[model samples]
Target: MAVVEGLLLQATSTGLLLGALVLLLVYYLSSSFSFKEEDNEPPGPKPLPLLGNLLQLDLKQPHESLCELAKTYGSVFKVYFGPKKVVVLAGYKTVKQALVNHAEEFGEREIGKLFKNLSEEHGILFSNGENWREMRRFALTNLRDFGMGKRGSEEKIVEEIQYIVEEFGKFEGKAFDTTQPVNNAVSNIISSIVYGSRFEYSDPQFKEMVNRANENVRIGGSAPIRLYNVFPWIGPFLKSKRKLERNTEKNRKEINGIISSLQETLHPDDRRGFIDSFLVRKQSDEKSGQKNSRFNDKNLLSTVLNLFVAGTDTTGTTLRWGLLLMAKNPHIQDRVHEEIDRVIGGRQVVVEDRKNLPYTDAVIHEIQRCANIVPMSLPHVTSCDVHFNGFFIKKGTTVYPLLTSVLRDESEWESPQTFNPDHFLDKQGRFAKKDAFMPFSAGRRVCLGESLARMELFLFFTSLLQHFRFTPPPGVSKDQLDLTPVSGITLNPSPHKLCAVKRS
Candidate 1:
């Protein structure tokens, strides 16, 4: 009877211990969830605890949602994506001031879980401090030697244009989707530099890589990916986010194979392409006491992949938008054709011709501004605590320089909502550069391929426009052509066939 009583006492003690533990857990959780920005922080819509503004934000197009909030909160405001707090700089002046005037303060790349998973901070795109500076300088110098923005590079683009023209001839002036052919042509220009060779459109390997790139972009920019970023612990349960991880690995492996082959054939004197150049640098560094250890194989792979991906999507989408907008706005199309015919003539158009074709340049700029491909710029981090534009932004605060807000700021453009080439044209009808025309972004983190992209867009757009006039397929009216992008991180025009009637 005494043993039984002792056992009962022990059970009572266990129950009290469990109860106390439960109370402790509740208190910790309650205290931990109390998230609030400092009093000196910018004012914004009040965010809920833990969830922050996730539910309130339109994750698909966070830029648009933020724009709506700016109407209430002003140019500079704070937002919470889950528990993570971000300060958004809206409109042209504010974004410019932060990215340009305060460049050093806001220079760091604000990497998220998804970006870290893909890059692991090895390449120029997601790196900071010494790594970014070294890689960017190397990339720019090499690209210049390879004829990036110069007349020497013009030959490579012109050669690629021939391939596109030949493929367009296969369409026989019938309605064909220009998406793949255009993508192939533009991508080959970069491939010739990266892989030292170009792939045929029929090549399965090339097609697979392009498909994977497009898919990765879609998934990476999706709502679920953002959710995974906000709540990284929940990544295991999200299928879309998991697919992104697999996609990242697949791209890395493919690039690695090409890099391996390049290594086998590399000669110090005969540097054929980017891989050869990088390998030569890596060897030089190894012998020089590792002064520049950033020139390793890992960085080579990541940088190559980043360049390959960057080279493909951004310019290709803009060109596609150019064609769609032209098809939709026939009057604009007619003006471009006239301008090209008068300035460039029927013979093969070149990058040099962009200067003479003012109307065409204006039209191209308008299309980019209207399409706004990269609506939300890549996230950036503050280098140190910054009191920017009347708000106390702490050190390492994530900053969203809303490119869409600047591109579509109501005060900056007379008709920001409408597709008007006049925005880029002076009252005298000359090509005029606007302070707000920042499609390539501003400051230090501007795309390394800006010059290359500019040349490609000019050469490809002119080449295609010189040869054929784009018109909507079948009964589709000009106004009916959907300008709204097929949703992704970048804006892609809806897949629609256009009749490329041969120019007489």
Candidate 2:
């Protein structure tokens, strides 16, 4: 009896100790979650140790997840990206407030490892301080002077649109992939501006450059970039990804070689292309004995490459989506065609044509909004220690515009999920621009190629619709419209081909 009683006492004591431990753990967890409720930082979902809210983030569609989190939190919320924390700005109000109102404070580029190798001293996209100011000013002025953001540029686009129309004829009304041909047209436009020349679609070197550009654009933020971020030292372990890196290096060399050859051939009297204009600037600076003139072959080459990269794929992808959408919605396509015919008649449509074609103009704007490319604008860093929406965003902290959230924010749009051009149009049918319509972004770092992109979108879209009615091949329904994007550095439609059937 005595032994049994002792054993019972030991068991009861063990049970009590175990229960206390469990209770302590529960208290710790609950306290941890509730501890920061009184703080001034923006409300956020609970984070796990080391990882924080990383596991909760959806890698595939981070914007969607962040949007959901925004409801529980607010327009501006902080979320952890691994050990790193990124403050996401959602909706027009928050995004505009940060990007436009406080533009300078948030103007720092994230400077990813990949871009560091490529554009360390290149131009405006990555450079800081005097370099950024100088290059940005020079590029902007030069582009504007060369007719980038004005009616003067319309002639160049009109010419390219004509070429695109000619190529569509080669399809003979048969089904084909419009990606390459569309890209070629855009490349020609940029090439005309930068190199003062355009390449034939048949040029092997041009084709190779196009391929490299496509590959680079397609691989951004892929598993490889993430892997590099996680295990940067393991570059040799990931051989395939290393190959992509090598290919990118090869592309840089080729671009440099081309620029070098062009420089040798450029005559002192003749200044054509952006590079030539830059050389002229350099020579003038030398004559003036200006020290450390930023206008050099390196800067010129980087700027040219940047133009091709940012302009080509982005415009091409949007057009790809636009045509796909038009095919799926023939009524909308017809209305656009009708507008083009009614407004411009048989004359070549110019940048000025937009004022007369409100419906078409609205449709173009809608396409840009709906596409929502660059979900996060190539990561931006805070320029200095600053406060945003009550959060203590430290200096050098990386921030994302969370553009996808803004574009598709239910709070801002009538039908956030649907493809509605009416969002950009008033009840009276005039084109109404939205402050939220920031496909090219806003403020200090707004797209350098905004004018060129808009011109291309209008010209190519109208020109194509004027020439042909795009549709799926017979037996394929609009339901089969591969709306599934090939999501990479750029949002692109799948490999589905379409029939650009020539209109009567």
Candidate 3:
């Protein structure tokens, strides 16, 4: 009887211990779930383990895919590019709010593996903190001094426009690809500011540099490179990455040669252009014995690379798109020509003339809107934990301000998908600027060359329209001329030809 009583006591103790453990487990789980429920992270499609949302993304056209997702998930939503978590800010209001109102919080650049590999956190585009600030300030000051948007740049652009007209005359109403000549002409504008001189269209070194730079821009947005950015371990196996590296090395060597030649003849007292000013600053820093200065050769090379690629590509791409859009929409082209002829009267178009030419100005604005280059304005990062649009975003979260959504916001544009110049025109036909016109982006990270790019677009575009009537190749109808852009770091018009019939 004593033995049976001891057994019952042991059973009772075991049951009590098990019951206490179960209650503790229940409380812990409930609290954990409650915490998650309260966190209020932006909702997204359920991410799979390890892969995240990779399977859902269209790697080639991520901006479009993300825009589509925003339809279901609203403006602020989370997405995973492989294992990397990203919060996308869509539409005009949200993007403006994040980038403008909360600039400090969303101001940092998200230097992904690809950009880090390319820039090494050295140049204005990829670097952050003091390096970015110093480089950007120096670039802006020197660019202004060297005639970025002023009379000096105007003269250079006018001179370049003549060369472009001459090139078009050679084609003589025959369909020819506008890519090379247009790129060369547009590139020379930046070339004058950077190297203090322009390259002849036939210069092998200059042509190679431009070709390589444009090629890198194209490949940098390829599927393999995008995947390599997400899964860097696969970089070694990517032909695209290898080609990019080869092109980068070749371009760097060529750039270094140019810098060396410039250095040999650089006069601190007679600064010619941007590179001269930078070298002068470097020399001064060295003479002062300043330690840990950011003005070193690496910074110089990287900064030049940043400026060269950006200056050459974005402006050239936009100009090309302008021409193509004109060919595709001859009616709009007619109005532009009419406006130019009526106001400017075949005399040389100048920066001062832009204000008088309202329709032309409106057309240019609409062109930028329709082109929508840089659809996913370079990725940004959150600088601190914050509540945005009622969603909690942690510090260091990668944020993409989807320019595509903003440019095409239904609430912002009358005809979001259609190419309509009326979008920038008032009822009385005056040039009207919209608040959502953020082609150069907004806030601290806006394009360093915004002023120059605007000047270039207006001058080059008007000059071209004045000199030539662009049309689809013989036997191709205007409606058939595809407006579909080749996806890249920037959207490029697909491979096609147009005849630049010289105006009488």
Candidate 4:
């Protein structure tokens, strides 16, 4: 008993000494590293040592919390995530000026430890400098050629929309979860682009891959991920962080499998898909003795993963929001149907129909505005020391361009808090363009698949609405439906069912 007590006392003393050392370290760092109010730093709530305003912010729905902060701090201010201080640019004007007027200064994407873990420090999404420049240029050129944001893309989308329309018909007017089918259909568009093929709806591999991808996105916004980004060495002990690491690895493996198959059958003369084009470019680079080329196998695989994941989730989740919102607001849905009937009755609705169906276009824009799927965009970094709005942001400071602020800025929208299609409509009911309509985001690093997503959203949304009237499940009133989103890096709807009643 005496021996045990002695051992316990020694261990307790050691723990106490270690804790004191940590406290001393924290105190030193907080005083030395923290920005002072007189430093011309963006004004914000006073941050606590080590915690750094973490308690003041919501981990789950940070944008909502950040919106509240903007009320107190104004459009441009500093907010710390952990010990890291991030300058948040809110409202349309502020964001536009920073991302547009000062593009070069805010062009670099901040690669947090978790993001590095996901991308393996390769890929366009997280890379910087010459690598990012080369990858972005290569990707944009090839994607445009393949049909992204072009007339050729519309044909691909229309083809895919037909399958989804048929799939909706299968429900035969009964309530069902449209999540899987919608995700599968939307993801397949990306699949067709990247891998040159789409998967069967019931394909187990396809379903698992998507589920894992979504999980990674969910994880990206989890507290564990935030912690991992701050303290990467602690990641091994966090299950969520571990799971995210595994998901990225698994995603890379799956993409590599597809790339390997494509490589074997890749014809030098004919570019079947993005992968083929990349392979052809890689070979050309090798032949030209461009030894330090970025078109290697690792880059190709990482980029494919990047495109597939980014393309699938943002657009898929937005489509889901569109259907749910329509169900909740039948009058708006009726108006949409009326416009479709008046504009493209007895014929397939195409992207061009958007110009004619003004109300429908307005509804789509309103849906995106309300959905605000990606509330806080991926963190950006200051490429150089920037002096803006009387604030001195150091070079390489992590910055967050909060989209939620712009999407729902009171100054910009007539009914920012309410779901009103009139937000996108003029007095004449013509579809009006809003500088604040940045669902695909804006400026240099705007979503790469913006054109593809727009085509998909219009075609799929119109086609589905044409074939079926979405509604709350039987016995569930529309008022009872929840529009509250599951907060993460992106906002997603909670799991719920809606009826897809066949239209006459």
For residue 162, give model 4's deviation from the true position in Å: 1.9
| TM-score attained by model 4 | 0.92
Q: What do the candidate models score in CA lDDT, each in turn?
A: 0.83, 0.76, 0.87, 0.83
Candidate 4: clashing pairs of residues: none
lDDT of 3 at 94: 98
Please identify which of the two predictions, 2 or 4, would achieve the higher TM-score against the true structure.
Answer: 4
| Per-residue lDDT over 1-504 for candidate 3, one digit per residue giving the tens place of the 0 to 100 score | 334323322323233223323433544454532112228899888875445676687767889889999999999999887567899999999999999999999999998798798778997999999999999999999999999999999999999999999988999999999989988988898889988999999999988999889988888876666666766765544556788889988989998998999999998999888999999999999999999999999999999998998999999999999999999999999999898888988799999999899888988988899899999998999999989999999999999999989999999999999989999889998889899999999999999999999999999999999999999999999999888888878888899999999888
Worst 10 residues of 2 by lDDT: 8-17
How much is 68 displaced in model 4, in angstroms?
0.7
- In candidate 1, stretches whose alpha carbon ends up further than 4 angstroms from where it belongs are 1-32
- lDDT ranking of the models: 3, 1, 4, 2
lDDT at residue 189 of model 1 (Cα atoms): 80
Worst 10 residues of 1 by lDDT: 8-17
TM-score of each: 0.92, 0.88, 0.92, 0.92
Q: List the residue pairs that clash in candidate 3.
A: none
lDDT of 4 by residue, 32-94 (tens): 566444367888898876657777876677788899999999988988765788899999999
